[model samples]
Target: MEKEIKVSIACMTYNHESYIAETIESFLMQETDFNYEILIHDDASTDRTQEIIRQYEQKYPDIIKPIYQVENQFSQNIIVEYINHRRAKGKYIAFCEGDDYWTHPEKLQKQVEYMEAHPETSMCIHAAKRVEAKTKRKIADIRPFKESKVMTVEEVIEGGGDFFATNSMIYSREKLAIWPEFYFNGVVGDYPMVIFGALQGEFYYMDEDMSSYRVNSEGSWTQREFSTIAKKKKHYAEVARTLDEIDEYTDYRYSQAIQNAKKGHQFYLLLIQGKFKEIRQEEFLDLYNKMGIRYKLTSRMKHYFPGISRLLIGIKLNLIR
Candidate 1:
């Protein structure tokens, strides 16, 4: 009989023919003793992405199972993630998008070992390399947590809880089955998923930088999200809506943190759309009052003279560029 799969590698892709090879090779490169399977969900890419996936599926028929959609399911309001995730037949579910790849061959080995050793951890993530897709420039290395270890909810809350890298998380299948309705409908993917996992138990962290996260790639979500100012505004509002759902789901246990995060999103919306008049609104006061003295003063300055504040912010952003 075939060995039972211990982890299901959940991968989703669309129009990533150039990078999908690396992604599949990375999965095939993993040196894990325990059985794992790759579930590649392709949502009707017009490019050669699906063809490439088919090639790999044939090469590793035992380890690679693919879901090919002729009609793009995302456009049909089908929850691609939920449906694909339900297909997972493993104790752990790990995610890696088609455009991203694992760097270390031992990544799955290390992550699985840690998860097996610690039953209470709802999920775990590690550092990942953020690379600019066009220039292939090494932009920054990120490890949201300070060090490698189990993290408390308070720690996660205080840190804005946007810590988990999308592909880096490996979560227990048991705890993940407790997902709420908001996760299926109202939420905008990863943020709420991480927050939900945090609610169940502590999330482990690994300091190792073992994955590559492509930024601003063609046809990628990041590229589309920042392609225009309107999209940025929409993205921010979507984040707020997701957090609102989480707020209800958690019964306001992380209310303060949720509020702070929403304010940050709203602030970004103003920046992207030049809605400076919104500064005088009462919505920001709660965040303003709780902010540090310097931030409070900054908020006051921005509120009183939004034009000047906008000019100054523009200058600062341009300087950074």
Candidate 2:
């Protein structure tokens, strides 16, 4: 009889011909004594992505299971649908995209052990190093929280500091089953998942850096700018709807959700105008006030000034880059 797998790695791939192999190799190199299975869902790719997946499937039949789609799903709906339909046997369900690869072989082992030891903890996440694809240079390091504790809804509303990259999180099967459909529908899926996980049980933070997140110009949602005002408005409405759904919870977290929604509203306005200069002092002040942030008009003026705002935003972007 075969031993049961302890972890199910849900990997989604689109047109990642260049990086899929590295991603798969990282999973293969995991130095764990226990059994684990990798479930790969390939959204129909026009490139050589399918070929690479096929090669790996042949080489690692026992550990790798590939779900190849003939017609493009285009959206994450099919990917999430596949994960739900297939039914993972493992106690823990971990996620990683084909474009992102793990840097540490003990990544899964360490997370599994932590969750196993802490019954109250529903999820575990570690830090990730962001690297530029072309230069292969280390751009920024996203470090995890040093202390492990139950995250409060208030903290989440305040935009809980550093969240584990979606690829870095390992969640229990019991908690995953309760994940709402809204998570997959949002422009950002990871945030809702984090919120759901925290609601279920306490979160375990591993300060160590164990994953590499590659940022490139191609095949990224951030790269595509919403050119039309209608598109921008639609995006913002979706964000608002998502936040409103979470607003019913009467906790500090609800404040954080409102603040996040306010920020999203401000950003959408900026994008719709096609220039950040279009944002007036009054507009930002109104936004801050609506978000419940206490600030004077003078401070708002300083923040809206082109030169000052540019310098501050430039520094922040540089830090991320």
Find the candidate with the highest TM-score and give its number: 1
RMSD of 2: 5.7
Instruction: Go through the candidates in order and give each one's C-alpha lDDT.
Output: 0.79, 0.71
Candidate 2: regions farther than 4 A off: 76-86, 144-150, 160-163, 224-236, 249-253, 264-321
* Count: clashes, candidate 2: 4
Tens-digit per-residue lDDT, 108-157, candidate 1 = 89998988888888888899888877555567887775679877665564
Clashes of each: 0, 4
Per-candidate TM-scores read 0.83, 0.77
What is the C-alpha lDDT profile of model 2 across 227-255, one tens digit per residue? 45666677667766666666654344465
TM-score of 2: 0.77
